[model samples]
Target: MNRLFDKSIVLACCIAAALGLAVDARLVAAFCLGVVVASLAEIAQGERARRASEAASYAYIMVAVFAPSFAPFAPLALYDIARRVRREHVWGALGAGAIFVCALVAYAHAGALPARALLLTAILSVAATLLSLRTAQLEREQERMRRTRDELQERALVLEARNRDLADRQDYEVELATLAERARIAREIHDNVGHQLTRASLQAEALRVVHADEPGVAADFTDVKRTVDEALQLVRASVHALNDNATDLSVQLERIVEDARSDGGPQIELEVLAEHAPANIANCFAAILREALSNTMRHTRAQNVIVRCMEHPSFYQLVVSDDGTGAAKTNSRGIAEGMGLGSMRERVEALGGTFTAGPRAGAPGWRVFATVPKQQGDDAR
Candidate 1:
């Protein structure tokens, strides 16, 4: 609109010179000055400037029409008014154009100007108004298209983040279930097979004592007792290995931390209070560890991270902290907005536990802590 208004000023000057050549050059100069003054208001930035410009423009059109020489520039004035003036005030432009026509016709009839010149002036005014409306329509359409493209790009990014969260959750669930099953099987072997082997070894020892005087029988019984003891040792060792593998939370966390450092990620520390923990709690803690590591790497600019898993008599707790500019500034919105941290909170809450995350107190960092109740099932014992 501003560009068209500027161009219209030049066009108006040309039209005034061509039509009013015989009139005093002073009147044409006056019309040019009036248009420039009105254009100043039209091209202004804010609403107040535009409204003041509109009043100035109306004054110019009303006074200019009384003289036949300045009459040709009326349409150019109408064009500027239509483009810059709001719709509610559009009647002002139409009324001004009407008055210009009536005055131009009266002047022409009184021999102030030719009939053909009046016809040309009316046609130019109508054409200019129509052209201004078309330009406004094209500009509105372009703005709408730009907004739609931005919205679609934002939606695509949200969907991609959700898909990744779902994939990670699914993998974590599968791994936890497998670990639980292994722990269960290991318990059954230790309780049933381990107990029977102990009894067999005890009976063989008694037989060796009773047959001590018979060389062949004593030697055979001694060999049986030693073999049973060795078999029992192997079974106990196997059971321990299975249990260790099932709930190796410390080892698992350390590996994750080490891998991150090796890949040029953050400096991380892992601490484990006990060598063994309940499989269910350990599994959940491992998931929490993986997610915390991921969130820190992806979202924070922290240089150092600390991950700790500690087991008590009745509960197990996991804490992941980082020395980054924490999300606590945004409060709940920061922790709840993202899928990764939100899911971690959900997992902890579902297990009847407490989950908390925010800026570390009196420090420049974020802290995530969760404590899950210990379940007294086979794995727990």
Candidate 2:
């Protein structure tokens, strides 16, 4: 748009100058025609068509040289040639120089034009050419700068995303480390302090038995034994609480899903809604899920598996299902009992939970369902 406006201003100035120099209507018409041809050549698309259009524009300017009065408007075509010559085209530069020489020769031979008028025309033509070349150079520089700015913006966005990912990874690692530290503390307390308290309680019981005949001494020893038992129970509860708090059920589920994915096996979707499940319940469910997934991968040609762990007001539920034809075959061949199904059932029943594994009743797949009541899970813990 800027280039067009510049060309428009140059064309208007040339026409005004030509009119001031007393150019006739015929010369003005020829100059406008040459300008129109040069503009068309500038906008031409293909190589061959552009070259042909340029040739036609040059022909018009050469013919206009005969009228000498058209000299003021000659800068229009020279401007375009100057821009093209800046591309380092040898033929274009030679052609432009030849045309300028011919026009000067014609102007010098025309007896009506003075030396000063000829000199002014030459100066005007050179100024327009140099202006056009500078404009082209500036446009190239602007385009290069624009591309560089866009590349920098893209790189900045990529780096910002990477930084965000790094921050998330750091937080995850910290949480895992914290959980591991808590578990270690709980184990240390149970192994060292718990054993010592149990031993003290047993020693107190032995003293109570040895002094059974002495009523006062036996009573004192019995009281000491009871106190040690209570302390041991409190320590045990504290250790259990620490271990439970350290267990992140959701994180464990996610890890299981990630491991399944890394195996390049069936696509597994796990939805764990049991946010505050007991540690025992969480461990039980995780074990069941791992076994279920293993069985699905090993025995079934399943493309998709879905595992859901949900906590209800009354019970916690775990369901692992797979869309595979192998379920029906396994049921028919009684192979489900041999594929770790017994272990899953025993784990659930030991916690007073119910377990079932078979083909889905109303669906074309296999479903493993287990539910442990909240009361049972708490008692187990």
- The sequence of per-residue lDDT tens digits that candidate 1 reaches over residues 1-381 is 545554565466446444634657755675576558546754677878877776666766776676566666666566667776577776777688778878977886797766666677677667767776777677778889889989988998998899898896676567667767878999999999999999999899889889889989989988998999999999998987788677767656665665677556778887889557655566667778888777777777788998878877887789999987645434533654477678888777767788888778998877999997776322443
Question: How close is every model to the real structure, measured as TM-score?
Answer: 0.56, 0.66
Residue 127, candidate 1: Cα error in Å is: 1.6
Provide the lowest-lDDT 10-residue window in model 2. 327-336
Segments of candidate 2 deviating more than 4 angstroms: 1-19, 23-71, 77-97, 111-121, 254-277, 288-380
When summed lDDT is taken over every stretch of 10 residues in candidate 1, the lowest stretch is 328-337
Tens-digit lDDT track for model 2 on 1-381? 656766787777666556545556776676767577767866889988777776765666676566676666677777776666634685765676577657777767865455665666677677777778888888889999999999999999999999999996787678778888999999999999999999999999999999999999999989999999999999999999899989888767777777787566778898989878888888888888888887787777778999888989999999999887763557542675764888899999999999999888887667899999999998885
lDDT for model 1 comes to: 0.73
What is candidate 1's TM-score against the reference?
0.56
